[model samples]
Target: MAQPRKPASRGSRRGRKPTSCTQCHLRKQKCDRNQPCNRCLQRGVAHLCGDSINSNGGFKHSQSPQVVSIAPPSPSPRPRRVTQPPMSPSLGTLFANRGARAFYGSSYFGHQVASRILSEEGQDLPAGISRGRDTLQSFRDESSSFAQVWDLLGLLPRQKSTVDRLVNIFLAEVNWSLDAVHEATFRSSYDEFWGRRFGFDDLANVDLRWLGLLFIILAFGVLLDSPPHPTLDVQREREEASLRFYWAARRAIVIAPSFYGESTDIVRAGLLVTRYLLYTRRVSESWLTIGFASRMAQAQGMHVDGERWRMTRKATEQRRRLWSHIYTIDRMISLALGRPYAINNQFCLTHEPENVWLDDMDDEEANRAVPQPLSLPTPSVLSSLLYRLAQVVGKIQEKCFGMERASYEAVLQLDANLVRWSEQLPPYFRLDNPDTAADDALPFLPWHRLYLHTSFHFARIVLHRPFLLRESITDRFRTSHEACMSSALADLKIRLRTMNSTNADSLRWAFGAHNLFNSAMILGIIAVKNPHSAQAGAILEDLEAYCENLHQDPWLNEFGMAELKVVELCISKAKDSRYTSMTAYPSGTPPEPPGPRIQAVDGSGRMRPSDLESPAMSSDMSSIYWPTVWEDGQFTFPGAADFSTWEQMITGIAEDNYGGQ
Candidate 1:
């Protein structure tokens, strides 16, 4: 069976190497080397077999190996399969741009997009790198671990009574605005959750989104119940506990793997997170998070009327409530920051939530259950009313503040719409009703009433703020001026009431702070421009009270100081004005007093760009009328014509210095 091996031919001898070819040497296998080695030919790397390609038998620095040799195939040769190197699998083409990646430090490639491309391309990533599917699978696996779930639950106060109290606080004080969680449904789930935690059921079956909802509730309770001015140690303890609960909530949401989640619970959790972010003064982050939650809700077709999809009655009502809440928050946050909102009402088909109690929705005969008339107040009446008002606010944002200068006709129309909304309110909820004390018996009604009035007044301010300047002042514009001032003063009274109420702790939040700050700014502007007006004393008193209130709230300290400085600056300017004794202008336009005197052909007291040729800017900085401090910390009067610039300066200070916090 065995014959002596034939002597190598001259060409075969020339082809055979003394050592292994580069491919075989690098692979550490025996090589029957020729121009193309036997191993290379078998592995389909015959074109890569050359000893001179790499002297030390290591790989070249090139991204891909060089093809050094290829032999013509024989007739009827066996099919060859291409094999990749064991050490480095082929990555093929990257989805990300190399230049952009280098410039932007790798984050230029979004995780979701990159993961999708890599998965499609069948690409290999380096060790420990996580792809999207890998991340989701890990989350699912971790969620199955009872120990991990238990560890998260263990971070909370263990007493059932304590937990109940916390949940009750959130439900009573905060949930009225959000209505993200239904009390009955949440209570039922919470009971089952604790049962599972205590081993009555499987922990693996627990819903992380609902668990996160509970954690968010606890965080709110801890934050809302903390004393106004706690001891440093106590404050620190409270902060740590609140943050612990908040982060646990966030972790639980991530474990729910809510990135692609479209469930009501996940969307509700996201909504609550936005609210929490807003309360904590992370405004921009809240805006971004709300957008994410909006997308999730939209993915579930929550933006469209659920009836069109023929969903269950209960599901329809829930989607409606949640969508209204989402839209409201989106408009509020976006309008507050002068950013565009996520939902355009024109494209949305979801109906407003019916004025029905949450309990009524759970009725077995829900289809037969009738919604309460708007004439009667229900538990959800506040939410229903707010939803309606938010619609008006959204319109105002679009018609009035949406452009550089809205037409007077559009302003009147939006103002009328606001008036109609107010007039339609029930007598019990009417801001103009003398009996503010009547609603105290109803839980959260007093608070809701205050909120409703403050929002209405704030809307009035926003609707008319553009024309508040002296340059824009005229008899026709007189209506806007009065509206701006009256609303500002009305909002101030409400603020004082809130500070004195038992609900003060719950009301000490940034949502109302923005309203208060805007009101204070408007009042300050009026007081400086019209120092001799009869209402000046009252305005200053209110502003002083506001500053005091701001000083008391730890969250509002910086804003409070900034407001104080502005108020003080206005008062000083008023006292120094030569027209202190002059009565307010009958036409509602205040006289512009002489300041850093730079004469011009137009003695209209309005400064022009050419007026800057004078040495006023370089002159002594001490004497000017209501001098404005710019971003660079330098004071400039600029002129009466530049009053809008002053407003911008103040707003800029607030946005730049305090908005992020």
Candidate 2:
């Protein structure tokens, strides 16, 4: 009792306001019981009222505390108060400063200093400005400043040094927007300064070798942008410069040996010489140059003797390699210009009728047909040139034949035999296929045969007078003829086996029928000229039978039909017309009549013969017949008939004008 000692009266107990049960028990804080206590409610924390303080420490209200106030605590010291500095002005703004900007824009030292500062700060600038800096640096490194000289003489620097410095400057400015400046400077100083210094009388007389060296240095100077520079004109200038240097070096080699003792340079010069000569119309000269270059390369151990320059092993392989690259480049140029490359000797043989046909034969016949020394013409200049050309082309073709080496030889033999075949056919054996027998045989025989004949004819023409065929001429004809023949044979075979099925019909539809007639015409030409030995004739007859069974096919379009008509006409003329009554025409003439003339207007508005000419008309009936009749109604024996018609035919066909016609 004395126990609680009357737990000192509430206010007097601690000498402070009495604590609320909520504060003392739940929150453990002193509470006055004011409307909102500073400790809890002011902090937005909820306040709970304890049972109203029991007067005697006995219950005066519910056991659990009652709510007095409701509030939340202030958030913890706002996350450490971070701070950041303001953003700096962009490059544009800095450049926009009136006083400094004008100085930066000026061409004087102020601008240079500003550029240096900006560059140090890693800022971007116009390419021209950057290029100017590069050029200045290169010049500084290559030439001593005028300030370094003890005397200020009025005389100019030596020509060689001046030229070197100018070239160096040009090279330095290559990457800059200084192209205009470089060009202007180059043009102005080239003749009066550099040209005179180098002992050149004029731009044309400038040592091509020196020019080439300069250009090579320039070419290797600047780095190229992959997508290319934004300015195509600049790119083009660079390329042209490189090519000029290359050509100059090449010309120097063609003219004379390198002045310097660098064998590599000499090799490069020779390669270029060959390339330049090949690109020109001087085919003979080009070949000679190439030969000389090859020899030089070999002598210098740049190339192996047996390998030419193409496949070689040597310490100076790079120099040897240049020859191969030059050869290839020149060849391409020749093709583009429709000029003949020295290596294109196999020209008409691969594409001409005679050669192509011969190429399509069995190896035995091809091997047997190789012209012996007796058969081949002796090596005169023209013959020598032809032989060289042929040898080169033959080598190329042999390589192309790859695994099927025999194929090329086969084709060549077929071509060679064509002329002989043409000479053996009888005059009375018309090409008409009464039983359509020739139709079956025609596609296979006539095209192959004609291909050979035409090829030989072209070769003779080129030998007598060289002319450039268009780049795609041979390829176009070869592809078209091959397609036509392939389709026809497939159809003929299908027709022979399956007479009425829809599949057979479809195949026949796809395979042209006119091919049969075309093939037969070709065969007839070959047969009529050579009454093939019985064995050959039998083979041809069998081939003919195999070809005629295809249905009325449609692949033979109007143009193809026209060609077939021409073939038929030629076969008929050969067999029926007693004109020359010759078994075979001379080397270059065809057996057909020339058709019509095509013309074009010249610049002066006058009519002139067009690039192409029409086929020639047949000789007048009287002219053709009277002589034969007078001589005897019987056909002239082989080599006995007047050859005028044959000559005219050959001339007409061989004329460039008659090409397509």
Candidate 3:
């Protein structure tokens, strides 16, 4: 082998002429000595092309185009050694490059996750096509006339009574969950904003961040204040009005160019926008917005504990509250999409917010404020509790979905950790225990408790979902199956009860819809696979109730209908023997359908006999009579359900796109 070339000495290169442009010189590539060199053009950095570095290692700029003499190659020089092809940049690099413009669909997880889980049982349903286009079109139509000049205050409700009602509704019914805006701060600012409403020196003097946040709050008020069991026309009116305010918030951001700023209100507005998008089933858009909000929060150093900077106690508390909520929402969107979370817990030094009531908090007098304990029932405990759970969820995402197949040991460990997290919950927040501290409780507490448990159970389902297959239902993995099933059942039952309760309006949010959809899917699979089992029968009943409740929800859109079809399809499969025989394959012969592909990371490989074995995984599965598709003691279950195809079929019917296929 030829020895590596020796380093050139300083004296040897002192008189040597430059051979490349600055861009090429830095990359150490052979460049043709043109104004914009061949290497610079090839590397897509032609704009950065300049004179090569001097012997002193300083780069020189050629003000005008250069005409340098090209050096001739020496006769019979040794050829350069061949090198390996360049590797593609990692995901971190792609995301971190601020100059790069990526155009992947914003909604990464909502439908993709549903498609994956539904695909694994036996069929590939059509992936839910995004509704982002129609949403954008509506936005453009609504904002077009006002694009040049929006009277920011003109977007507000004309009547003071209406404004007061909306503001009061938001502070009372909605603020508990978000805790993004401080009530005291907002009230003071609201008075100041109206007092100077007409005194702005043009729109530039307006507080765009505050204006955006106000619009978002008003949007939430319109959205959440709907009467129970609203009619389609009423729902349409409410949605339009809500969108109007939401759009105004977006326009405020555009005017302020808030993406370039680090204002907390802008971040707050972005978070609220994310939640609103989810409510409209614009899941991809929500994902994109939340990601941008996460970056904005990081830019403000919100991920770091504020106390370290010697900020006022109230400011520190506010930062903690905002950061925790951001982290919570980030994990939620990530988990729902089956994607990696934005904020890593290891690097996040901010602690959970104290359970201090908004009334007790005073930015100027934090010394007098007394925070409620974790065991006490307080509105401030909501985000703090959610952050604790999000930490566990972050671990679950890494251990299970992070690998092709999580180790059985890893699954059990994560499940234990999750159970411990649930066990440590205060009695007021616990599902099994009743809230005795109702003396100072908010009306939303009951709904809040259910919401937290819904998330907790959802995490359990995701963690144990891989080991939930019937083939993997041995004694060692039996707990995993039970945990998954129980969590799904519990989730559906809770949703059903909530729907029937007097507080039925509380279940109108997107998180509830997403969780309910996921649980229904899991139960649907159980019903199909074990059609004759009493457990399957119970699951079917709950699934039907869920469907009925879903129909009553004003937020139901195409995606909602798609979810309905998913459960309906599962029900149809269990009840119709003809469909079953037509769809099902013989034992050992799994069919290859041209549908949405199943993810290998979903624990498909781990179910095989060769991949996992335990003393409990004996030949005798006599008690359970769900028809076996395994052949020769190998996992070979056919993919009988095509969720993407089925969804496409349903959507085609709805849109009349199939031409009577």
Candidate 4:
């Protein structure tokens, strides 16, 4: 065996100097060595342009890039013991360079993350795919990124029946919740593809971006199969195939730069992709993806009024619809992550979408419809309702989750505003007025009801979640806490029942598995905190049903079933205690209230459990043995704040590609 070579000393004299940036020099390429240097600017890692102590063991230029390394790069390209490849930079070392070392100075740290990623990927980069090359160019080959997606998912079957069936499934299952693309447009595209191609060889008829969108739609059709067909092996196979296509679509989009263009296709795909990422519980990645879609919308001026751009009436409506979806996604993700909204309201002036869905418009007449006066506004009741929710979500983030802590009075005012919002909603959309719902709107009534209710309850959760950290609830804050519990119970009750019901349907809906997941968690904690309550049995049942609904989803399988089992077991123990008491003292008499007296950590006095066996009812807890909301069995379920590390890395590429906010 050979010994490792000693690193060269900085004072050592070296050979002839190289004329390249540190990145270029490290990769053995020519460098323009401009301010950001050609390679750094090309890779959009311009901020990472500083020269390291170059291989010559001396400063190459006075205008050296400010980047610092853990230590100098190995003097020679290959270490003395060439049998094994050297390790790329360690995570701790990269973080240190970015944080304490302040690698980028005043520039955003997003690029630092990308540079480190390319550094780590250095060992495997192909000869033509240089590290400092354009970021998009480097990602042109995504086979590794989407290894599971290489196989065709049969999204475009030759049989018209099969294509129709899958299309129906997507439309029937998730369309209401996502309403991502116009159904008419989607079917037309599907028809065009199936009519022409039985394989990839004839796929030229479909645009790469649209093909990607089609794959996602098919994947969602399989992934969103609720109350799945119990006896069908084919359904299972399709699901497996759908996931492969979904990931392949993900990979394909990254490979096709045109997919990111500021057009409806990219915006639709981005929104749906973000939604799919979130549903699969890829919460952090969803946040990152939504940022891309949001920027794309901004680039297309979707954030501004159509009149300002001189767009046609139909074009304006399409822009509004796209903007609405992006805005909702933005709010949902920001709230889910407890982060600030990426779209600054000060810069946004796009009007809310009108009552007309694109499906209702005739393409020929759509142009003529643009001249209608804005004063006679009739909103897309469902879309507009969701848009309002997004607005509230934005404020909730700012007033509640932002740098400032809202006062008791401020919280109360916001609560009142939420209530007022529901009151002002169109009568038919209100939960209380289903009997008066329009005949044509009946198809979507249940969805709207649930959506309206979920928004109210979820908002309540955000508003009072802070109370859990408080040592005590004061008189002013007492109502707010009560409201939180009340809304949570209400949110769970309707959501669980509607989702489980045979008749439930929505034409264009918001709120589903994602909402239910959170709802189950809130209810579980409430049941655990007050375990002896009469409602405990129902709470456990709700959790059981939620688990069933989510079990079919591969990405959610681990957290979904595992979290349910934990909640069920805890509640079961309490139920057993209750049964024992009832057996001791028969029916007519009051048996001893069941379960431990463990009050959950509600941010007030109940920080820790009252005693050991009982713990805080938190889905986000670090462990199942302790108190956890939803944890991976492998002990790696990303906590709400735990995703912070990935947040930077995930969004890093967006900064490089989209050129930052």
Best by lDDT: 3
**Local accuracy of candidate 4 as per-residue lDDT tens digits, 134-164:** 4333333354332222333333565667556
User: Against the hidden true structure, what lDDT does model 4 obtain?
Assistant: 0.55
- By the TM-score metric, which is better: model 2 or model 3? 3
- lDDT, candidates in the order shown: 0.61, 0.32, 0.61, 0.55
lDDT (Cα, tens digit) per residue for candidate 2, span 1-661: 3655455565332444345644334434466665444433332222233443556644342222222343445664333332221222122333321111221233322223322322232344321222223323432342523111111111223355644554554444331211112233334534543524222111222333334434333333321211222255655564454445444454444443322112334444454444333322234455555555544444343333223323222211223224343333333333222344543332211111111112223445544543333222211111222222333334333432222222323434433443343343322111222122353433333222222222233222211111111112234224323332333333333334443334213222222212212333333333333332233244245344533332232222333344334434334443332223223444323344465332333342222332322222223622232211211111111111224443343233323222221
**In candidate 1, which residue ranges exceed 4 Å CA deviation?**
1-165, 176-180, 197-204, 227-229, 258-260, 358-361, 434-441, 472-474, 501-505, 508-517, 553-661
User: Is 2 or 3 the stronger prediction by lDDT?
Assistant: 3
Task: For residues 465-523, write the lDDT of model 3, one tens digit per residue.
Answer: 65554333225667866897888888877767766432225524444424423678777
Clashing pairs for model 1 are none
The 10-residue segment with the lowest total lDDT in model 1: 627-636
- Candidate 2's C-alpha runs over 4 A off are 1-251, 254-258, 277-285, 305-320, 326-651, 654-661
Please give each candidate's TM-score: 0.64, 0.23, 0.64, 0.60
Q: Please give, for residues 28-131, the per-residue lDDT of candidate 1 as tens digits.
A: 56777576766655444444567644444344332234333444598877555555554233444334421111212223222222322322333443323333
**lDDT, candidate 4, at 225:** 50
Candidate 3 similarity to native, TM-score: 0.64
Could you tell me the lDDT of residue 80 within candidate 2?
Answer: 37
